[model samples]
Target: MDVKRWLEGVQPRPATATFIAEALSRKAGVKFSLEDVGMGGVITPATLELGLEYTAAAPKVGSQLLGLTRRDLAEDPLAVEATVVPSAWTQPLLTWLLSRPEPLPAGNGIQVNVGDSDIRAVRMTTQLFMKLDFQFGGGHARAALAQYYVRDVSPLLEGKFTEAVGRELFSAAAEVAQLLGWTAYDLGRHGLAQRYMIQALRLAQAAGDRMLGGRLLGNMSHQANYLGSFQQSIQLARAAQEGSKGIASSTTMASFLAMEARAHAGNGDDRACSYAFREAEKIFDSRNIGDDPEWISYFDEAELAGEGAHCFRDLRKPLIAQEFAGHCLELTDPFYARTLSFIRLVQAATYVHQSEPCQAVALATEAIEIAGSLKSKRYLRYVSDLCTDLAEYRETHDVGRFLEMVATKYPAL
Candidate 1:
């Protein structure tokens, strides 16, 4: 039956009719199962392992990407609820280190022709989504991005285009895929995020974009650190630096080094973290933004400062963490609520470490207020961590009030 017939309450319901109900549920913000929509029978969920491999071949990369995107569109439960497998990071990191960029596959006799204009439009749309992600957090437009990828960008990959156009198109697709992974990570969907990042790395390799590929590895390292896979995170960061050594711009390289520093801090390696931070700062000092790719434009002074703040916080350097956090707050754009909230939490944690509960409460309250508008699970986790840090001073009046406020606002925590 046609979709219109289903909407019009047709008598016979097809076995595949659940998709319509799923779409309606998402749109109306109301739960609708197959039974609720008058469609019966179970729909098997997509497997969690569908897109985890880092395929050495370009064609397989495309296939994996398609599979993952389709699963996302179908709203499979596993896509959102799958648990993180830290062991999955091992194979992808090894594959990236051992493999080189593969040549673009020839078109399969499709008559469709993709041009520069098509590539430009894809890039513009990607930029708009990226801006929304930075300003409003990843939960805002992730589904819309997935839909756009399936509807528009997927076909261009199979269509005929010149070598130049193909490279640009693949690069654009990689950006979108990376953003998808980032949004998933922000939502605390680590399994989905890992799959997207792995596919994105392959796409970047297909585009012969070593710089972007390195950045993707850095992203993996960041996620690994978040998951407490600190050793894997450090290894991935080193792989990113080694893989893109000669070609990466100063800003890109600095970002990679900072990721290394972050992983080191997570592992409690103070000396190694300090060395990496010094190198990142030196490289960033000499950077000329004009020479960098537009994708790396977000790694300015504020970003570097924020990274430092995170590193110091992890390394237990409370005073230095406060200094870096303060700098980051001063320089960050107000539109980036997520970033601001994270920095505020870092600053508040530093105060807790310094035995200043009142000051910590003030900063943490500000952070909570800023983050209240976001739909980020990661931010909530950060808030919970700060509250844990403040436990030693829970008897104090300010700390008690702060705990009450948090319990009132976020009973789940």
Candidate 2:
């Protein structure tokens, strides 16, 4: 019954493990799935391999999405243990790129008609939730978003609508599902995030929203890069670019290219990273915001700078990283706490790379202070990584004080 023992790798009873995982997740500001804590038992390879496929048909995508959401609502343990299969990435990317968008099939269930007003309402609600996600962390209103999706949005998918309304409805639903995935990713629930993203991509495809589909693939690329699957990340980004070619607005293309640059930087391919970064900058500079889809309105200069900062930080170009990070911090909205925290961490890491332990510790402490207000595991990990970077300087007075402060604030770290 000692939680400390469970933290030390002692496996508890399944039911006990579930409670412990939830408790630990809350305490640590990171989601700990049953499998993450070693409570998952005898997971079949088949069950482990769910949610990887990129289906060709719209109906199949809808069915899969419903199943995913239902299992998520029920808190099914297997849903938490879903594996991130490396081989799964390539085929799906290929399928999505090679296939054309499928038309929305006729809805069968209820006679209820989903009109443009309903679609507009869904978009407005999703935009509000997206703003919440930006201002607060994903853990803030993720449950509410999920509940809304299941309760309100899911039914609309089954209702009768004209071809135009159906397309708009599916696109709006995809946006919600994509937000669900983004929230899960922010909470460090990568498996669940992957599942939602896959479904979102399918829904976007069904809606014939090529730009949105590309954006979903870019989301997958971002997640894959975060999970250290750099090659997969690169492929996913490229797939996004290829799949949306000629159609994607400049901003969306730039975002996809930025994701590719991130993957290249993570893989230590400096030349490739530089090439991609240049392309992203060029496209972004020429972007006509008026021509972009509503969903891609978030990828502005600040976001692009953040991505550049991350790329340079990973590539060990501290000076350039610091430059980009500074611009990102200046341009980013104060309401975007999580993003600012991340950019601050990137700046802190640049200081560490410059061998300025005192400056690094000061900046990192500030980042941790900002992160303290959020519930993002990824932000915590960023703080932890800064701590790791400062490990070599632990003997220094500034770093020692910083470490003590971190211990006081986040004992789990």
Candidate 2: stretches off by over 4 Å: 1-50
With candidate 1 superimposed using the best TM-score fit, by how many Å does residue 400's alpha carbon deviate from the native? 1.4
Q: Candidate 1 lDDT, tens digit per residue, 4-122? A: 77667553333366676788799999988655776532223433475777666675665567667766766667677767778877787777677765678655538568888988898
Give residue 137's lDDT in candidate 2 (0 to 100).
83
Best by lDDT: 1
The TM-score that candidate 1 achieves is 0.87
lDDT per residue for candidate 2 within 71-147, as digits (tens), equals: 66655577755656667667667766887756676676674778889999999999999988887788888778887
Which 10 consecutive residues of model 1 have the lowest summed lDDT? 39-48
* TM-score of each candidate structure, all chains considered together: 0.87, 0.86
Q: Pick the TM-score winner.
A: 1
Clashes of each: 0, 0
Candidate 2 residue pairs in clash (backbone atoms < 3 Å): none
